[model samples]
Target: MPRAKRFYIPGCVWHITHRCHKKEFLLKFARDRNRWLDLLFRAKQKYGLEVLNYIVTSNHIHLLVSDNGNRDTIPKSMQLIAGQTAQEYNIRKKRRGAYWEDRYHATAIQVDTHLASCLIYIDMNMVRTGVVSHPSEWRWSGYNEIQNPKKRYAILNYRRLMELLGCESLDALKEVHGQWIEDSLKKGKPAREKKWSRGIAVGSREYIENIQTKLGVKAIHRKIHESKDSSELREDQSPYTAIFGTENERLRQENTYRWGLF
Candidate 1:
């Protein structure tokens, strides 16, 4: 089959995820998590990327991010980010070879509805794993950032997140976010489905269709590779986006200086 077109457009949001080899608790320790986060931050600074939301589970990670329009550096920046993370993991564990199972999995998010669904899926991941009763109870995710807006974390883009969520005021943003989490918690843990792979078993048909359009294909295929167990495959690796970059240069320009912000 022919390769599909890439979906790395300026201002287009994507839900990106990656998992460890064999679902082996790659991020079981605090240092492991911090190391990954540090590398991600450096990538953000170097590539002009913006993270809308993220969650780092023991074996996998979920990220909602958008191209900062830096077409020249997005790929290079991501390579550095993933490469450094893997290197650190191997060095700390005294092991060699792959850390994450495969290249990252990502779906371009084009609509507000899709954005809402993605956030819901990410926030409820811990609950689905039986680790927490509610999303707000999870400390390593954007749900906590929603709960405490005063606290700023490099991994989350709260202001833009609120704008995407249709927030006109701080109170409104908090109220809507809190309510969304409560709703997801009330739904209880997500049940695993056999046919669907990665993330919640179901999402809006519209969202899926939109992604298919962006991918320039009617269907998305997963090419699963083996070097691990069943749970490990599901836990640490996702056959997501292999490529993402923008073609527009105007969007790549830094507006901070123009606004007298820097």
Candidate 2:
């Protein structure tokens, strides 16, 4: 298959996914996962990457970030993290070949309910796979970091997060976030959503169309898909964009910044 082309758009949030080479479970161990997170922290320090949410799983990684309108931030940070990770792991194991499946897949996300939904979806990943019953059970995730914030080396932009969620305080955000999780769990086993991993952009009609316009040639052939709740722009033949919904209380938060996405 041809390498997936990256579409760059400034001032947006992005959901990034990268998998281990041939799904070998390279990060199946805690130490490797921790190393990836450590490199992620350093990438934050070195590049000012505004990480919103993340999860380092056995064979893949999910990162939710608010681009700072600096085009190089995302790619550069990825290079540092992925490159160093692969190099270190290979040297440690005395192995060779690719550590990553390819490069990665990035989906632009609309802020507000869509963004919030994406956050919960990411945290629920392990739960969906039955690795754990709840997101808190998994240590390598932003959800854990948020509920139990670290005094040092913390990730996630709390203030910006609050602004995005239309909340006034961390306590409120936490309460609302937990409620969202609880509400989600009550819905039973969550199935994987393709929009986050496959779509070029996910949001409302206007938002996706706007992204498509901005993407110009790259998105020329892609099409927008509309369902009852939301709209998405996706390729002709694959998992594409999506629409979403949350009942009453979950629909409260209605909204990121000059975030560049890759």
TM-score of each: 0.71, 0.88
Writing each residue's lDDT as its tens digit, candidate 1 over 178-249 gives 888777767767764331235321234554444334333212352222222111012223233432224332
Cand. 2 TM to true fold: 0.88
Top candidate (TM-score): 2
After superposition, candidate 1 runs with Cα above 4 Å error = 1-10, 72-74, 150-153, 192-262
- The superposed Cα distance between candidate 1 and the true structure at residue 123, in angstroms, equals 0.8
In model 2, how many backbone clashes occur?
5
Question: Model 2 segments beyond 4 Å from truth?
Answer: 236-262
Look at candidate 1 and give me any clashing residue pairs. Answer: 8-245, 19-236, 20-236, 105-240, 105-241, 106-241
Kindly state the number of residue pairs that clash in model 1: 6
Each prediction's Cα RMSD? Answer: 9.4, 8.5
